[model samples]
Target: MNRVWLPVVAVQGLWLRSTLRLASAPGGGVSGTVPGPAAEPLRLAVLGDSTAAGCGVTGDEEAFAASLAREVAARAGRPVAWQAVGQFGATSRRIRFRLVPRLDDDLDLVVLLAGANDVLAGRGPDLWREDLTGILAGLADRAHRVAIAGIPPFIRFPAIPATLARHLGERAAALDAVTREVCRQSARTTTFLEQPAGTPPADFFSTDRFHPSTHGYRLWAQDVAAQLIPDQPAP
Candidate 1:
């Protein structure tokens, strides 16, 4: 089926890329201080691709990384100091090799949101698992906890054509399964947070219809907050 759809997907992908180039807006970095009243400061790092970098939103406060920090702080009663390192088209392999080596601080938590590009690029599940294993190992020395953010519903994204989206979504699900297994095998790696596929795509997506909007960020943060501070009420 993918063979039959590949050419069509490729054509649509080219148009989609051009459209995104024109439609995508500059998203502010969601790094630095996420203020709270708690005396203890939590050092956090977010590592992955565009969604991890908060591509759809304009400001840091509106990005998922910043929103998660704020929610975690509100729930844990501690200040969360966070830094985000990601780009729009980065793959899991790139993140493991290029991005992970540059980290300079010990962190309380690290949130990883990637694999969408990997799925789109037709990376296999075995390779994804290997990359995830390496990524978690790399983070073991840097953070006390590593949280894996599961892939979104690529099939539901309005920017993606249905045929390509279905193939990508299936690949994303396969990669996510690998991620879950990797997390389960590691004590330092915690939960895999995911967006429900049943969700209305329009409500959670941004104007560009690919990356997350503020609403999506808030929802994702809520999920992360629940995992980070399980005892506290959901934010």
Candidate 2:
């Protein structure tokens, strides 16, 4: 059973934490518009962890927020004004308390990338559900629509040890399941974006071999754009 590898996994997890250098979170782009057909730009806020912060890339433009906003703008034919709000290793609980309060009620769309930090912290399912539910509920009151990113398949991440990744992957799936259920309950205003399938290639990661590179974020944006735009316009 996989439990036999827990010792090795624990050691590898510790080693990775000590040796791998984490990328810094990027900032700027207070206001701008992605040209599209609509008169008013679709205001977008990309929130949560490293994914939202675009940690592995050189600048904010190369991160997920800009890429996803552009993707949504192109497909929806609406100019998008975007903001990237995130911390490098924040969990859902932290985002709920720290970032969620900073948002205004005028956002047209919100995409949250969370749960990986919770998984790494070994947070329990009940707490994850509470934190995630709080995050979604708070955003629902602010944004016209709330879309959440499914946790990535850690087992496929080249930087992670297979034994540890398998465990984390299973946990990620559990958290994703909880998130999907929460979204289902609020089907009118919230949607869950599933993580892309298949094993990730080397190019999917940055130089740190941990966080996503610009290439990976672009690919993810394409998938998110296709899924989010077709939903009914939020009231």
Candidate 3:
């Protein structure tokens, strides 16, 4: 361990404890079947960490995956069957090791929200890339389209100490860069980099100030759905 990181690690431990107590655990998986008249409903899977599991929000409807499904359904005029598989504090490697093996086949889309935990855990970009290679390869083989959402803006997260925020922000940016490269390398993948969208901080973030609130989830879903569903042809 770098000697300079010692104090940061100590602060991180404290922050981690506080985050756990304040941010709800990502326990039950999110799943729903949106009804439609299409012959085959769109099959979607979301895999990643706390945000993908919807740590800050209550109910599946309020989470990013479900909100995205609703948006896509409305755009495509078809039913969507979506499911989310994630856990709190899951790094990229953990998702590859644990979540990838259980993913269903014949998925139309798979959305991945990772990297923040990897950055916070001090994992380097190489490891992040290796993990994503495995995760994306699996999803690419199984799903028609794989979408990679950018890591959460840790620097802007209200729960983190200002002293540590700059350092964390740098790491998050590095990880997001790696994420972008991974997506770019694959033709089937779509990438979304999270940035300030002019939405009020209080409106988007939950009480924990780390994970997204329902409104935040909505914003993210809108972007994801737009990418998944292209503009319809003129009638």
CA lDDT, candidate 3, residue 47: 89
Every model's Cα RMSD, please? 2.8, 3.3, 3.3
Considering every candidate listed, which one attains the maximal lDDT? 2
Which of 1 and 3 is ahead in lDDT?
Answer: 1
Mark the regions of model 2 whose C-alpha exceeds 4 Å error after superposition: 27-31, 230-235
TM-score of each: 0.87, 0.92, 0.85
The TM-score between candidate 1 and the true structure equals 0.87
User: Residue 6: error of model 2 in Å?
Assistant: 1.4
Q: Candidate 1 vs candidate 2: which has greater lDDT? A: 2
lDDT of 2: 0.84
Q: Give the number of the best model, judged by TM-score.
A: 2
TM-score: model 2 vs. ground truth: 0.92
lDDT (Cα, tens digit) per residue for candidate 2, span 52-154: 8788888657888888888988888788889877888899999999999877678988889999999999997899999988898788778998999998888
Could you tell me the lDDT of residue 159 within candidate 1?
78
